[model samples]
Target: MKWAIAMVDGILNVLKPSGMTSHDVIGYLRRVLQTKKIGHSGTLDPDAAGVLPVFIGAATRLLEYSGEETKSYRVELRFGVKTDTADDSGNVIETSVVFRPEQEKLVAVLKKFTGPMMQIPPMYSAVRHEGKKLYQLARAGITIERESRPITIYKLDLVYQADDYLVLDIECSKGTFIRTLCEDIAESLGMCGTVSFLLRTRSGKFVLNDAKTLEEISKAPFDHILPIEGAVEHFPELMLTDKQALRISQGVVTSISGVAEGKYRLKTASGLFIGIGSANNGMVKADKVINPFTQM
Candidate 1:
């Protein structure tokens, strides 16, 4: 089998439009870039729009670490309505006469959701249950119990409020379902609610302002792609000599110093990112070493 060299090897901060699945973006880029070595750091619901970091070539390896980074969103919640999917895209399961709660009460309720909490994955989500996707089972009129998973809401602020709708700015850990959080907030306020709109403002270090729309990406230079090292800039860096870098590239364990026990971005003394390494007890071992000869 023959593989063509990729045109670029980095990340694209794409502003995914609503009504398009994350895979849809990947497919589009595949056609544009003419390569299949691409992946997204996170899944954004089709009904939501915002910053989506798409990794190309060697950058795809950084997804595991980047995907775990914190994400921020601006969400709109419509009270007095409940949906099976917990968003406007789902069928309305219940409705109530809309009533606006006091600002103080709303603030109090929002505060309670901050910090760590267990969130139930919605039936209309992509979460797998018993070897099947929850959404697939939902469309077939089947519902199954799902275990609640621990998630953290680093910050949940009521940005704006009206008679029946409210806007919230949320900063949360990975695996958090904003729809579920909205529903829980409404329940706590003695009403029902569903996500009316969701816009991710940030995913790790990538922000919406820096994201490129599909049209922009089409017209932009290929150099718009950021280096793979930028994706893992949050990690501590361990610069190695040429000999040490070569050894690490070969998946060999090497001694390292002056770094805490954790993951570090492995780079050559000249500052070329080689891959990732783990530093523990003064020893460093390759976690995922990039082929310096092949990587951009």
Candidate 2:
């Protein structure tokens, strides 16, 4: 059977429901859009739900840059329990008496996590170890030593608290594990804990409120797709001349001035996106040129 070709190239902010792995979402999109060139910017746990940016066609090329963007989450931590995976989905490893710390004590503990710190990745994670996924080894009951990675917590605020449950709003850098953070917080308070619920509120510029569900995406029009330019709108723009545009398309480095020494979104005089490039010392090097023709 002949498969339908997808000529569209853009990004889709999807609201992934619980019980679906990040790869599962991709598989579902492949069937719905009839395209294989699809990828997500970041991975969300199969048990967690929220904003997952889906890139289609040429937008897949933007994944590397987009993954560097910060993420925000609303997480619920349940005290008096600890799981092997640091989340409710894992096997119970330990338990303790439910103790709700005072608000001042909770605030003090959260302050220590703010800013940069070292974090050891959980065993049941996608991180690769010895040429195999950590989760793969975790399933076999094999545990290996893991090096701690540096991560930053830009903001950590207590949103709500009850007898055994505490909700927190966290804005952190990429690669952060909310489950691990919750476990650490509990440990600091002399108790055991795990992430009970997680919801990604924002990833880079994409907000959860603007995310489309699988049902909505199944019936979405082409207009629902965001252009590749939208993915890198935060970068400075560099307008190119016809001759320069041609050189960029051919992977030729053209001299440029007036722009700062940094990455920029190369575009034509008419606002047509060319690609991304870097400008420094009156020279602009072609990074990735999308359009060849000067006119649209």
For every model shown, what is its TM-score relative to the native structure? 0.95, 0.95
What does the lDDT read for residue 141 in candidate 2?
A: 93
The number of clashing residue pairs in each candidate reads 0, 0
What does candidate 1's lDDT look like per residue over 1-296, in tens digits? 34456778899999999999999999898877778899998899999999999999988888888977899999999999999999999889998778999878987888899999898898888899879999999999999899999999999988898999999999999999999999999988889999999999999889999999998888773857988887888898888888888777877788867768999888886677888889888888888876462332
Report the lDDT tens digits of candidate 2 across residue range 112-165: 989999999999999999799999999999999999999999999999999898
- Candidate 2 colliding pairs, count: 0
Q: How much lDDT does each candidate structure score? A: 0.88, 0.88
